[model samples]
Target: MSALLVQPLVGGHTGAAPAHTGLAAGHPGFLSPSGVEIVFVLVGLVTLGAALVTVTTRQLVHAALWLVVALGGIAVEYLLLTAEFIAWVQVLIYVGSVVVLILFGLMLTRAPIGRSPDADSGNRWIALVVSLAAAATLVTVVVDAFRATWIDLEERTGPGQGSSEVTGTALFRHWVLPFEALSVLLLAALVGAIVLSKRNSDAGSGSGSRPGSTDSVPARRNKAGES
Candidate 1:
């Protein structure tokens, strides 16, 4: 009777040990990434490439198209992170509305669709230095902030928690001020773009006229009379 109980207890302990070991093995670590992480990294690379092309390309239309790709890649990243609502919103607002608005603005302003010599300001080296500094600062801040933090993703094995309702609630409840501020910023951007385009158009129209605009018409009329 004693031997039977001992044998069963040993078997139970042995079985439980493997269960714990399997769980620890399943947990993801920094060096061991899951499929989702791999996809996320790949999409991030593509997004970065698209963003670089958008900024570096000489053709305005091609840059806008690459901007679309970058924005779409960000949406894909949100989807991969299980924020489906945010992903869809990103697609609808940024990819659909904002990109279309940009294209329309480009067309209405008569911006060059092909390569334009005025695209770059000949400050590539300065811009690169500034960009590298900014990137380094951001990376340092983020790493320092998150280095001590650890998220137990194993506890979240159930369905996603980023439904539209939940996200909307969270946005309105906690981030309402920022949300309104962003809307104001976007409005400001639109107004600024319109103002700049109008100024450019006025400047372009004035460029074709004589310097002494008030006297040129009179001078032309006198010449015609003399002729």
Candidate 2:
């Protein structure tokens, strides 16, 4: 019994080795020749799918989650193309920070967890047309710009590439202002979200209270008295 089990296991391993070796040897030639183009197509498809879901999904949280996936795919593409710095930044900013903030905003705003017809806008057709036109314009511009350049796909960088260092230097030296501006923008967005939420809560509470209730009356009187 022992010999039978051991023989089968050894034979299975032996049979798998050649297949694995063949796949490994062939994969680089196949991938290296056309990997970048394949990845680009895949990235575009993923991004489009995610964007469609984001717009069409009735649940706000689902949209945000789809956005996370889209952003992550972009990061992966960056990494695949040897842009390590951009990839890490994408993960740090979009996946780590922005998505979390969006989720927080969704939770704080008391958005519906389930699908709702109210979430769908009536002007979806107009939006779709505009989006298609913009996409076509971008594609046209890109094709016009790079139509003559031949893409060499097999020349991928190894682990020793200086992408991170150069990116850091560029960010600090030339793009410092833009980086700072982004921080300011994020801060402003946070403040705006907080203010809007607070205003909504206040309005809700105020509406729930009787108009001439003593608490409101005294507050109004105090304001007038102070003025």
Candidate 3:
């Protein structure tokens, strides 16, 4: 009994020191990332490239297609983060529904499939400056906020950590109002786009059929009949 007590007092957990050091060494460092980190970085790069092309491309169809790629890449990133539910939701909602809706809207509006000079905006420089500033601010804030936060992906944790059930429950329970509001907002935007397109089409048709226009067959026929 005395020897056991004396050993602990003298050694002062000397036997456990190696275990702690080994565990600390086992934890991966930022500089030496695992396979998952490498894949995540690669996916992020692809997603960023897709997003840039979506915004800068003069072809509306290509832009919408690239937008799908960007949104799909985001879903892949969510999958890599182990958020399966969110990944599927991203794929289904944004990649599937929203992108398809955008394509349909483009088709309905008779938007140009090829390069369109109208797609090139006069305020591009201003938009770029604002985007860069906002990106920088967001990066700074996010980095500062999550500076000390770390997750041990390899370590086993409780089932409640990243499960679909927990996510679904939290989303529906806490975020239902916001989700419904967003759905309504999307509906409104869709309706507005259709209405505006119809108005523009009507104005175009009306202008083309003006009574004084020489190209109008009805006007020419009327004058011929009067004469």
Candidate 4:
């Protein structure tokens, strides 16, 4: 659950504080543990529901709409972590741009507006197996990595904005390659989409040329009349 992730950053209820821990002891947070926990649970549920609907819905446009909700919930989660920049990126990139692009593609391809009976690929069994395997792998990795870890927020941040600085450094130093690769991947996908749209338009124009064949009949009739 998402609440489990909050444990390291916000501390659990049993006064588990190291001597140097700044947030776990006497220092008070803006929101109480129960309140934060409740909000996290609610947001998580909304996100999960949206994701499920997005995948399960047969309506293409409705799936995009639900995707927006799921992406918005992720942005909210980032905000709850006080990661403003990440939250804004999620809103601007994923929710706003990507979801819009998806809708545009669906419309451009002339997809059915209502339920598409053929949407299901009949690979539910294989997909379900793969999804469960992936989820179990991720859960195991996360639990093994962070089960006992604790972050003392105040100590980590302090008066110098150390937390953000460190995070920035780590992101740039370690994750830069992956970020750049992802950007390139997105650009390639965008280009492919454009190519596909052009091909579709060309096909449409070719089909329209069929009407021109009827124009020949008028010319032949005129010649016959003149003769």
Candidate 5:
């Protein structure tokens, strides 16, 4: 009887050991305290640098590529938290689909393939100021709110808990409405893009047609003038 009771307690404690070890591993590397902090700081700096470059790059394509880097960094951060499903979703949605669509639009619109003075506009300073102010405000708010909070880095597993399974179940069940709304939003955006592309094509066709190109001049006058 004593053995049975102690067995349950021992099992419970043993089950928790791996999770504690995993959390202590600190994201596949940086087993030490300073190393973990260094990794986190480096990831943040890279993410910020990529974002700044994405915004400030004059080349549209370069900016889009920079955006990919920034987004990939975010995905990495998600992965660090052991949220593989969310990280892959971020990569698929943002880096794969959205960026491809943006590049397609740029190509279809015949946007200057090379550097253009018009690409670098006059409002850069204003945009920079606003961005910096917003970032500062957010950082201040977050720092103040969490300054004294202690984060428990414990990896607790429940019954049959996997990120992909849980995320899919949650998305399809409780969050179905938001998921459907997003689908609708994507559909609307696709339709708007199609309409704009068609309009541009029609405008280009109209401009290419000269006034006399389709005119039926009097046949007799044409023959006489040609002779």
Candidate 6:
């Protein structure tokens, strides 16, 4: 506890390991699969499935909805990991706000309500190869970087173990720049959405307000050619 708690940074958590690497090998209970782990696996499968559907669905609205499901599953996974703060933020910021913003963007842009033909790209084979290659490269890098490293979850609850407070502090202190950058990106997205809505509205009004519109009386000269 004392060892991990006083870290300037980087400890046994320096790399990665199996998801259950921190399980105590000296204890029999840790050797057996736990119900929590089973639930975690189920949640992971759901997340993966929802993510696949979100990316593959031809219907834009359905894709957005599946994205909500995927993000919600991620929040649940975070909760299962006991990262309550991150879990709630994921729910509030991503599943709730981001998804809502995306839906609104679709509506404002007058996107297709039904299946979008453009959703399917012509480069299916190329995309499949690129995705597989990327996935393989990531797997190789992660395995090489964190072969046997483990995060001691049991230590985290100890008084001396670094916990949520320490993590939040580090995030705010060391990670301020990235957070600020993300905020800027979100602001840009919001402004872009507003601009898109304005353009669509302007176009609609322009088309509606035609010269000599049928619903309106056109200016005409009397028989003497006087207005």
Top-lDDT structure, candidate number: 1
lDDT of each: 0.78, 0.74, 0.77, 0.73, 0.70, 0.73
For model 4 the local lDDT of residue 32 reads 38
Those runs of model 5 whose alpha carbons end farther than 4 Å from true positions after fitting are: 1-37, 150-153, 158-162, 199-227
- Tell me which of candidates 2 and 3 scores higher on TM-score: 3
Question: lDDT by residue for model 5 over 85-129, one digit each (tens)?
Answer: 988999999999889988887775566656656776688788878
Q: Write the per-residue lDDT of candidate 4 for residues 66-136, one digit (tens) a residue.
A: 99999999988876666666787889999888888899988756778889988779998899899999999
**Candidate 5's TM-score:** 0.66
Clashes of each: 0, 0, 0, 0, 0, 0
Stretches > 4 Å off in candidate 1: 1-26, 144-159, 171-227
Off by over 4 Å in 3: 1-27, 154-160, 171-227
Expressed as tens digits, the lDDT of each residue in 82-159 for candidate 1 is 788999999999999989989997885678757898888889989999999999999999986544332333326555
lDDT of 6 by residue, 1-227 (tens): 85567452233233322335545343223356467677888999999999999988899999999999999999999877767778878999998888998999777566787988888789978998999999999999998675444343453444333346766787899999998999999899889979976984575457566754423322221222331
Is 1 or 3 the stronger prediction by TM-score?
3
Residue-level lDDT of model 3, residues 1-227, one tens digit each, is 96786655434433433323332244444566779989999999999999999999999999999998999999999878878788888998998788888999898567876889879779999999999999999999998664433354543566544568788788799999999999999899989978977984575568675755435555655665554
Each candidate structure's TM-score, on Cα atoms with residue i matched to residue i, is: 0.63, 0.62, 0.64, 0.60, 0.66, 0.63
Model 3 global lDDT (CA atoms, 0 to 1):
0.77
Candidate 3 is scored at a TM of 0.64
Per-residue error for 83 in candidate 5, Å, reads: 2.2
Order by lDDT, highest first: 1, 3, 2, 4, 6, 5
When 2 and 5 are scored with lDDT, the better candidate is 2
Locate the minimum summed-lDDT window of 10 residues in model 1: 146-155
* Displacement of the residue 198 alpha carbon in candidate 4, Å: 4.1
lDDT of 1 at 184: 100
lDDT of 1 at 135: 100
Off by over 4 Å in 4: 1-34, 153-227
